[model samples]
Target: MNFREFASKNVHRNIKAYFAYFFSSSISAALLFSFTMIIFHPDFVKVDLPQYLIKALNVTTIIAYLFLFFFVFYSVSVFLKSRYKEFGILYIIGASRKQIQRMISIENIIISSVSAIVGIIVGIVFSKILLAASGKLLGFNALGFYMPVKAMIITFVAFVMIGIVISIFCSFIIKEDMVLKLLKGTKKPKAEPKASSILVIICITLLTVGYYLSITSSTKTLTNRIIPVTLMVVVATYLLFSQLSVFTIKLLKKNRNLYMKKTTVLWVSNLLYKIKDNTRMFFLITITSTIALTSIGSVYAYWRDKEDQINRDFPQAFFLSDIYDNKSKVDSKAGFIEDSLINQGIEYNKINEELKFVIPDGGKDNVVIIKEDIYKKLISMLSLNANFSKEDESLISNHKVKNIVLDNVEIEVVLKSDRGLIPTFYGEVYVVKNDIYEKITGVRGYFGAFNVENYQDTLNICNDYYNNFGYEKEDKYHNNLLKSRILRSTKVAYGVILFSAIFIGLIFFVTTGSFLYNKCYMDVIEDKKKYRQLNKIGLTYKEIKRVLNIEIGVLFLLPYIIAVIHFFFAISSLRYAFKLEIKVAAFRVIVIMLIAQIIYFLIIKKRYLLEIKKSLI
Candidate 1:
């Protein structure tokens, strides 16, 4: 056959090889495109977002893509290995090495092209769905809508360039096969875990220390040591897998019941065989699982850090400030009118007050409003760690308390504020004050939240407050406050869910994909047992089918259950590592994660079972 004819024939006859190669290339192409689109987006130029955010995202995307690049490349190698025997047969059939190489090259190229087309289509759908979801999450249904054309073009160009180059590389690599090597195939040495016990010990020790370091991480010292401990943790996890799989399997086997129960005996036996016989697959699965978990943990931590910021920084639910240079047409006293509609149990603290304005002659920086002697005690309460002298201390004790205002602002700016001090009056320990304080204060804004009767009431009140917010004439102190709070909370929820889902996806990608590749690889080595023999001796094809289902089900479930438990301990370790002192809201987050995991598990399980059925046939 000519090269084209050979490729078409080979691709049709060995459809699995074609598929493996295609999917590998497709994922690589999609990733490259995703990175290119996210990093070089033109719309970022027009958006009113920060430059640092774009730069950060660019760096993050590059790092992520690099990881994915290696991921795709490794998967490609697996596909190549799976085709070893077929290539060997082609070489033995009086085909010159040059002719064989030409045929193989074209086959790979075709496979890549087919896979890339499918991946691009899938990626576009994913991107569009993400955009719609993000828009809803952000509560501005109009904003951040994805235009796929630009992204598609960027992804297409990126993947095509990379795919073409990688295709050539794969073709060239395949040419290294001698007929004998293909016939026997490349045999990896079984894992010698007993011989590597010392290395395993070191890896385990290092991992333990790394975990300890993370757990003991002080929030105060978190800035300096985060990188080293995290890196060590990652390295140790992979190393542990490399050096300890044999040791672990042996330990598990010691439990006779575990090794003997129903399908458990078969699973354990098979797993041991897998770990020893398929060292490369074992390594890939471990590496992929660790990466998936770590990525989720890291991203969730980044997002959860915001919780501390929000809970500590903002003391008020409603903060309405005076907008500059605008005359009020409506009575600002409309708040009191609104208050009258509520029952006695509802406490409406209407705080209408303006602080004396103090600024350096030119309005260059944040203008600090100078507080009156009357307001000094109130100011101290807003900023934590605020200490006033003995004179101010006496004033606090002697000053009468009719109302308390929870003035929440940008914490740092609040501390360094440099407004002129309002003029002092002698010993005027005033009793009750009226609306005069509100006018003099310019009613810059109200800073208060409702202490509602119940939790649902709290949500209703907060939502109402969030909705009523608008720019007032004298209000300019901290408008970024609203967006900051909303974004912080939204990002926490988003990052956790997003990271978990992506991690699970990666696990499926690495794991189920690895299992498929392994089966293909073994089919070459295992053909000595004829398909006819496999059907003999009480083992029907249907029995093989049932066994395949059980094996796959075990393969997916065992690691997953372990992963969830490990993740809990892992996050608990996170709190200890960061020294973030609080009882974690773990139950709620876990519930959400479990729900998502169940959905993802079912989808992947269904697809995997379908794929397994195909692999068997």
Candidate 2:
């Protein structure tokens, strides 16, 4: 037969083995194509989004393309490794090394071409839905659907390049291995694995240190420690599976009761060897699971914290400062704003506040002082029932630090006032009694905080007010406009990240599942001998099934459990660092991931038993 025909037949015959690689490559290409389509979408460009965000999307698309190359290449390599025996058999049957290489290359080309075509088609169909959703999130009035020929061409070319790269890579891999090693494949038996106490200790130390750093680092200090902490955690995670797990399992094996039990002995013996051999793959699974959890959790947390974030960044819809000194100006501006709001039939509530800045001897600067009565009035107006005694000092700050506190108040100012007077020292707001505030010789100002029924409508009124009389006081709608602008940018950024995280997470998940499946399949050849021996010793099919269940279950769940532990600490750090209320988001991420993992485990288990049962029979 011609090599092309042989390659085609081989590919068809080994469809199950190729399923994971093909699906992953195709899905990755689809994601890349979809994202590229967004970047070059004709309607997307016509939207009123920022150029920088568009630029960011372009950069992300490029990065995604680069990432997919490595990802697809890795899956292909794994798939090739699984078929080493096939190549060896061909060689033994008088097929030259070049023939084998050619066959593999032809197979890759055919598979990749088909996968890429399917991927691009799927991506094109989904890009419209993605763009429509993104448009709504970005506050775009319209992002009409149209085919992006440029994006399609880019995706097609990039994936084709990847296919070529994989083909070349496979050739090199084949050339490096001896014919005997290829024939033996991954089934070369070795002595039982021994745990390294030093490695176990190092793993424990690293994990402890990493978890400590993650949990204890404050919001301000986290960024500095993040890299080192991540490195330590990654190294530790590898060792945890590779060394610590082996050590612990060995210790458990020493227990006669658990070790000598019917199927436990069968599974445990297999598991001991399997765990040692599969450590690296287990580490990969754990890391990817952690990535999926953390990425999805972070995205959900940001979305969940949106309201608080808005309030923290933009305290009020409109803020009028230093209006006390000029009553006429204050009356004019406030009257115009209220009149405009009334004219537009927009509902809003207004608060009159007297703000004072105290020049403190030490601590922080930019501190605003307000009378306790005003504080109580604000609390009452907000329907908050918190009590503040005359002696107790209340602070309003975005950050929570030592010597800092929070009240239900939001203050904004710097050392320099609009009148160009520089305060000697200012810090956080101090809600003090009227007597203490009066004694401080503080710089006083009129502060008006406006809350609108409709944020956009109120922002429009504030903008109109700014255009009329409050232009000099840019602080009013600076926060509003800044808030709107930031929200738009954040929606886009988070939307992109969320979609990417979910897509990539699913890829990693599927890839990991496939890894486990491939490992099981590889073990099948070796396991046949072991099962034959067990059957001679009267090991029943029921017992064999139980062993297979335990084996696959442990292999599947160990990494997942470790990853969940890692995510726990990670989300904890995010909570403390960003001061985010992430319980709901965390809960959602955990539940969804658990459901997905269960489904994947069930599928793998069913297939694995079917394969192993053949050996048992």
- Residues 237-333 of candidate 2 have per-residue lDDT tens digits of 9888789988988998999998997678778777888888888889988998898889878877886576567655554455556635764555556
Worst 10 residues of 1 by lDDT: 419-428
Candidate 1 structure, TM-score to reference: 0.62
Residue 447 local lDDT, model 1: 28
lDDT of candidate model 2 versus the reference: 0.70
Which digits, one per residue and each the tens of the lDDT, describe model 1 over residues 1-617?
Answer: 66688677877887654454455456655654444443334543444344555555555555555554555556556666767777788777776767755775666556655655766676666765644443443233422445557667655555455445555566665654466778876664555345277867877887677667656665455566667765665566555555576678778888997777655665566566554554555445544554455455545554555545344334333333333332132223235323532643454333334443322233333232323433453443333333333322212222222222223221111122221111111111221122333333322322222222222234443444445644333433423223233444555355434433453444345334545444443443453243336555454556555554565554444444434443544555556654443234444444554565455455544554455444445
Question: Model 1 segments beyond 4 Å from truth?
Answer: 20-45, 94-98, 123-128, 137-147, 175-177, 186-195, 252-267, 277-280, 297-308, 314-376, 379-570, 577-617
Q: Candidate 1, residue 601: CA error in Å?
A: 8.0
| TM per candidate | 0.62, 0.83
| Clashes in predicted model 2 | 6
List clashing residue pairs in candidate 2.
Answer: 365-426, 365-427, 366-426, 366-427, 367-426, 367-427
